[model samples]
Target: MNIIGGIFGIIFGYVLIRYRERIGGMLGDPAWAASIGGIYNVLIIVGIFIFLWSLTTMTGTSDFLFSPIINLFGGNTPPAPSDF
Candidate 1:
């Protein structure tokens, strides 16, 4: 739904923006519409890809990101000094 909505909005907005000159005869002017639509489309695409990539990459391996450092130290984490 997100992708579909984004695409639909982008297409519609692009059409209105790109044809602003022609549409000027009717609507005020859609200059910003084109650039805005382009920007929106780009943002949506980037966001969707990033989200999908992240989902597929959730390796549940907590250590895959940085546990090796803890393991290298033998996993015996020193407790912080007690201020009490």
Candidate 2:
């Protein structure tokens, strides 16, 4: 599967490079480029926010996503104090 995928990728890349000028002329527009860039920036900012939020609100022993217990098993919420 990997070999087939690699061969296909090489062929696809070759075709893309061969027709890069034509493809660029067809696809390139200042307004389109600007819109795509704006969207990409927005997604990046949103991703950063999500990462920070996950870090902050995490209840497990480890602050970051992956740690010994957390990675091996799953999120371990801290146990409540015994009233007895």
Candidate 3:
């Protein structure tokens, strides 16, 4: 899925770069341009942060950072001992 997503991203980026001039002209209003750019930047930052955070969780650091949240949600308890 990651590979497929990366391929799609590359294709989409290539198309965007190819048609940037036409797209810019259509969105030429200063307010429109600013809002569009701002939203794009915010989403990119969030995506990068999520990817890096996932790496941390996969490496077992989630215990340090997420244990409280898990415990708060009642997810970290061990099973009760079985009676003989």
lDDT of 1 by residue, 1-84 (tens): 555654555565556545544555555434664665544444455455544434334534435644777779778587789999
Rank the models by lDDT, top first.
3, 1, 2
Q: Tell me model 2's lDDT, rounded to 2 decimals.
A: 0.51
> What TM-score does each of the candidates earn?
0.31, 0.34, 0.37
The candidate that wins on lDDT is: 3
Q: Cα deviation of 20 in candidate 1 (Å)?
A: 0.3
Choose 1 or 3, whichever is better by lDDT: 3
Give one digit per residue, the lDDT tens place, for model 3 in 2-80: 5555555555555555555565566554654466574344345445655555555455585788788899999988989
Q: Would you list the clashing residue pairs of candidate 2?
A: none
Off by over 4 Å in 2: 31-84
User: Each candidate's root-mean-square deviation in Å?
Assistant: 12.1, 13.0, 7.8
> Could you tell me the TM-score of candidate 3?
0.37
| Candidate 2 weakest lDDT stretch, 10 residues | 53-62
Model 3 ranges with Cα > 4 A deviation? 1-42, 80-84
